[model samples]
Target: MKTSILRWLLDPLTSLLALWLWSRDRGRRPYDAVWRLARVTRHPDELLYRVHGHRPDDPGDALP
Candidate 1:
């Protein structure tokens, strides 16, 4: 249910918001947000590891 809503609704809104933010902020672009999302989704553990001060490259850091 959550994924469906995000895919169908939130993604578009996020894109639009990114675009709007990009237009107002010269330092950042809309594509940056999309790129970050892609990276995080591809490695879901990355964000968690970063927050917990764990190194992703460490074998012991990997979640089973």
Candidate 2:
């Protein structure tokens, strides 16, 4: 119930933000930036691991 309500409130805001980003990047498809943002937002830890090349068990991973 809580998750659903959060999604309901954020979905429209996400769409509008995506549309704004799409307008800024004219060379890319409308969905490109949104999709990338969605993927990162969905799995930020995975993105951080890939970017920093650190194992999940590393001490630095616990900073935040």
Task: Write down the TM-score of every candidate.
Answer: 0.32, 0.36
Residues 1-64 of candidate 2 have per-residue lDDT tens digits of: 6743554466756555555676777638636445446445655755653333223567886787
- Cα deviation in Å at residue 8, candidate 1? 9.6
Candidate 1 lDDT, 1-64, residue by residue in tens: 7643554374665455545555667646445554344435555666653233234668776878
Lowest-lDDT window of 10 residues in candidate 2? Answer: 47-56
What shift in Å separates residue 16 of candidate 2 from its native position after superposition? 0.2
Question: Cα lDDT of all candidates, in order?
Answer: 0.51, 0.55
What TM-score should be assigned to candidate 1?
0.32
State the lDDT at 60 in candidate 1: 70
Clashing pairs for predicted structure model 1, backbone only? none
Off by over 4 Å in 2: 1-10, 30-64
